[model samples]
Target: MTGMERMQMDAAEYRDNQPEAKSAVGEAYEWVESFLVPLLAFLLIFTFFARLATVNGISMLPTLHNGERLILQQAGYAPEYGDVVVVDRSITDEDAIVKRVIGKEGDVIFIDFASGEVWRNDTLLDEPYINEPTMLQYDISFPVKVPAGCVFVMGDNRNHSLDSRSSDIGMVDVRHIMGKAVFRFFPFNKFGGIS
Candidate 1:
């Protein structure tokens, strides 16, 4: 073959390989920008709205464990009594605690330390779901009416939990609440909606 013809053939081969090289690089860049970037953004949004938390202490024991993974819903809502809630204690200077709502605004709450019973407006509460049979004696037992736009929360394992019972963390402001614990996602057997 002539030298010029051979050179032209080599040039064509190089040009042919260029498109394949460019295509491989383009696929990689598109994969990252299209799939990876958006996937990470979605995760950040999900974590902000629905957090994944691991139970760290025995404060909510029996009802929740020290290592269980829980799904916390973050949207603000008026939580009803008996709903398990995840609280943001930074505003109160207490650690993050998971507790059940026991009373709401405008309700009179009385804790009978001796009987381990809670009362709302002088009516005794029937709390069969509590982990412990009796609550330890708390120093404050006066019938404190929950202030307007606040909630009274307590741990299921009442004896070990430091909750609204403490004056420092008194009634939790409705705004400081982060979300409710609506499901447990880990430890296969325990995976289900949080009661």
Candidate 2:
């Protein structure tokens, strides 16, 4: 071939090879963006901002069941009345405990065992989530004020739960709270946000 013709042929070959090189780099970038980035983000969120916990007993029956998996939000969790929380070693020798917040710091809690009523700050709580009426009484006296940075907790199953009502596990400290149970992931049939 002539010199110019050979140069043209070489240029065509170079053009043909360029797309494959660009395609490979583009594909790698796409993979990283589509998969790796999202995976890393998920890991970071779960590690720092959230956690996973499992229900161990029937104390929170009708609301939570045994072996049920839950998504707990850790960062920025503040104890609020009616929120379900997972605590860290608050109960004696127990790894963790899940209970609903009944009262916060400075709030007064009173329970009338005969009437099965729970009063918080002079207002009777209309607790529809409870498995039964609060008839089972423990050692703690009624109208007790929650100490500073502490919260009173109880299970939804009032008759069966051993919680703040009992002297065994009374008021929970704010620092002992690991996270709040926001959603239930296991037992797909009952999968939804924790009420």
Candidate 3:
């Protein structure tokens, strides 16, 4: 055989012996298309729609506990009374705390420490989620009206929480809110939607 023909024959043998090389590259491209790209999209969607937070203390005990994992939804967030929410603590403290919205702007809130009854806008506020009586009155006096563009929030564990009732946390500005606590995802036993 001629030198050129011999080289061509060798090249054909090499190609025939290595059938997997082409398939391996095609499989890699398929994996990138099917898995990697979708995973990246999923991550972006997750981060945009929700926030992940860990319960840092027992402030919301009996409802949420320390080290528990939670999902905070950020979409179309409007602060409403009774909604559990995650507040950004930069304006109040070093770390954030989760609490339930008790009153909104212009809502008059008053607590009777003796009876443990909360009054809002002259009506007795019905609170079944609180862990205990509202006995923890802070330095701030009550019959307080939540300021314009602010919200009154309190922990479920009222006796142990520093919340809107306290001067430090005050009325949380709507801007300082991180998101609404929608679900608990950790501690498998407690995995479900939150009120």
Candidate 4:
């Protein structure tokens, strides 16, 4: 037909002539390099130091959101105040919850509902990331001392979160603190480290 059409047909014919090798050994090696090796490496990495998780609710909105993907880092993790982390409920086999650390072992926690101020061990925490006031009071009252080996956690969407303040998930043990959410890699608009 046309010159351009004829040229395209000739190009397709040339490509068909240079198909991948039919050698079994060569094909197997290529498959291993392209898929098996990388898969094994990923499994090893995830098993030892990291995991992939997704935000499952709106509890952490304005900081992290539902359906956003995260890379949870576990190696050498020490729960620190203000670090957003994933807490596992292995005892119940429930999906993990992501929350921000508020008070650590041996610290006192109090929240003034009227002023929306949170004091940990007599110091007002500088929380510039909270979406709103911490108005949701749980079964446990304030001024409670966190146990010797646990952390008090709350979501950034404080007014509507169910966290350490509630007896339901009170004082998460350090052992149940699975990993810190180090990175967010979904919804290209919010691609970066988890704050």
Candidate 5:
């Protein structure tokens, strides 16, 4: 063959012998889309939108037990009456505490230790979720008014919990509330939405 024909044939052979370049790039792109993107999304969702917390004590017994895993909703969460929440250690020297919001800001809370009753804003609470009556009295007195940007918290296990009624952890500030417990995921059998 002529020199030009030989060069053309050599170029054609080189092209034919090489592997497809697009396949490698396409695989890399697919890996990012299928694995990396989803992993980042999952991490972001778990970090900002939700969090995992474990119940540490028997304070929330009957409603939540110790060692139970909970999923907390952090984003756009506002504490409401009767909502179970996790509080950080801003008000106490201990670690995080979990309790139910008994009263919100500006609400008057009165616990009659003699009668084992709790009254909020002069309304008697229908607390069927409490493990027992409010017979255990802490240092904080009744007829207390929840200040602005604060919440009164209590444990379901009334007699055992050291909560807002106690002076050590009295009146949790709104800023100290980490998140609201939205679901229970551990123990497999008890997996469901937290009430």
Candidate 6:
């Protein structure tokens, strides 16, 4: 082939390779932009609304066991009395404790140190959810009128738990509440909604 024809042939080969090069680059860009962005967004939203926590001790006992993995919801929702909940303890020196809501805003709570009996607004509570009924020893007796925007919480394993009764935990501010433990997803057999 003549020099000019040879040059033309080389130019044609280079032109043919351009689309393949462009497509490879386009595919990479699309992969990062499409998959990576959504994946990051999913992680952010999941971490923001829901999080995974391991039950460290038997504070929850039959309700939640040690080493069990739990899904904690962290959204702003009204919590009813008797609902099991998880609170954020990072703001204070207290450890993260799971507990049951016994009283809400405007309720008066009384604890009889002698019998471990709890009275809400002069009515005794019938708590079948406790891990052990007599395990609780009411050391601190207080007639607290739960303040507005706050909640009174206690653990199911009341004897060993450091919850609202302790000065450290005191009455938890509603704003510090992470969310309720709606379900337990680990230890396959115990995998169901957390009552």
- lDDT (tens digit, per residue) of candidate 5 on 1-195: 999999999999888766566677788889889998889999999999998888999999899999999999999999998999999994446789899999999999999998899999999999988999999998897799999999999999999999999988999999999999999999799999987
> Is 2 or 3 the stronger prediction by lDDT?
2
For 1-195, candidate 4 gives per-residue lDDT tens digits of 999999999999878766654466688889879998889999999999998888889889899989999999988889998999998886988888999999999999999988899999899989998999887787988898999889999999998788998999999999998899999989899889977
| RMSD to true structure for each model, in Å | 3.1, 2.5, 2.1, 9.7, 2.0, 2.9
CA lDDT of 28 in candidate 6?
96
Q: Global CA lDDT of candidate 1, please?
A: 0.82
Model 4 ranges with Cα > 4 A deviation = 1-31
Highest-TM-score candidate? 5
Residue ranges of candidate 2 with Cα displaced over 4 Å: 1-15, 90-93
Provide TM-scores for the models. Answer: 0.78, 0.87, 0.88, 0.82, 0.91, 0.79
For model 1, which pairs clash? none
Clashes of 6: 0
Q: Residue 23 lDDT in model 2?
A: 100
What is the per-residue lDDT of model 6 for residues 104-154, given as tens digits with 9 covering 90 to 100?
999999887667788899999998887765345444448888889989998
Model 1: CA > 4 A from native: 1-15, 33-35, 91-94, 122-124
Q: TM-score: which is higher, 1 or 2? A: 2
Residue-level lDDT of model 2, residues 1-195, one tens digit each, is 899999999999999999999999999999889998889999999999999999989999999999999999999989888999998884467768899999999999999899999999899999989999989988898889999999999999899898998888888999999999999999899889988
